[model samples]
Target: MLAALATFGTSILSALVPFVNLEVYLGVLATRIGDDAAAALTCAAAAGLGTVVGKLVWYWLAARSMQSQWVAKKLSKESWKRTFDRWHTTLAGRPWLTAAVLLAASIAGVPPLLVMSLVAGALRVRLEVFVPTVAVGRAVRAWLILAGVGAVLT
Candidate 1:
């Protein structure tokens, strides 16, 4: 019980920190908890919840700061402008595509969660859509990682 709570807290912290790799963390957690399927699933769920919470912070901040002077200054840069334009073009007018891309990125880590979170915010993805997609993707990924680690160790 205590370990699960600790894992939840650690997952949140790790998710917030850019340097912490979640897959490795889950692998370690799986090893520590042994082959207890219930415990493994609990930890995976906790990690997924933590990841969504942390990523939501980034998404919110980006959305809020879109109109800020600082963001304006950053966007003024040619490179930044190009990046923003690309993201806007790619994500705009295609809700299903945006969701699919975000889900794939969250589960597979192709474009990286940090990048996707920021892009989603900048592109003004609806929170109602973003939250559930990210949460479900993170949960599935965490479960797969834990299960794979358990299989390898046992």
Candidate 2:
């Protein structure tokens, strides 16, 4: 119970800060808790939930920041607007493709989730689509990490 709560808290904190690596935390937790499947699953779930919540906060902030004069000015630049428009055009008509890209980034951190989350927000992706996709991707990634740690430790 205590470990689960700790995992939840740590995951939330780690997710909010890009410098903190959640996988390393999970591996350390696995080492401490032994190779218990239930514990691993619990930790993974907690981490996933935490990640979703943290990213949502980031998304919200990015969305709101669009109204700021600084952001508006930067976006108004022709070159910047063109680049943004290109991405927006590509993503606007394709929900599934956007979701897939976001999911992949969430899981693998390939494009860096922070940037993706901001972009998704800036693009005004639906929360309905964004939340579930991020949650599932983060969950699977956490589960895989826990499983690998368990395998090595056992």
- The C-alpha RMSD of each candidate to the native structure, in angstroms, is 1.6, 1.4
The TM-score that candidate 2 achieves is 0.92
Pairs that collide, model 2: none
Per-model TM against the reference: 0.90, 0.92
Candidate topping TM-score: 2
- lDDT of all predictions: 0.84, 0.84
Lowest summed lDDT window (length 10), candidate 1 = 2-11
User: What is candidate 1's lDDT per residue for 75-123, written digit by digit as tens?
Assistant: 9999999989998998898888888988998899888888899888888
Task: Give the C-alpha lDDT of model 1.
Answer: 0.84
- Tell me model 2's lDDT, rounded to 2 decimals: 0.84
* Clash statistics: count for each candidate: 0, 0
**On residues 18-42, what C-alpha lDDT tens digit does candidate 2 reach at each position?**
8888888888887877778888788
Off by over 4 Å in 1: none
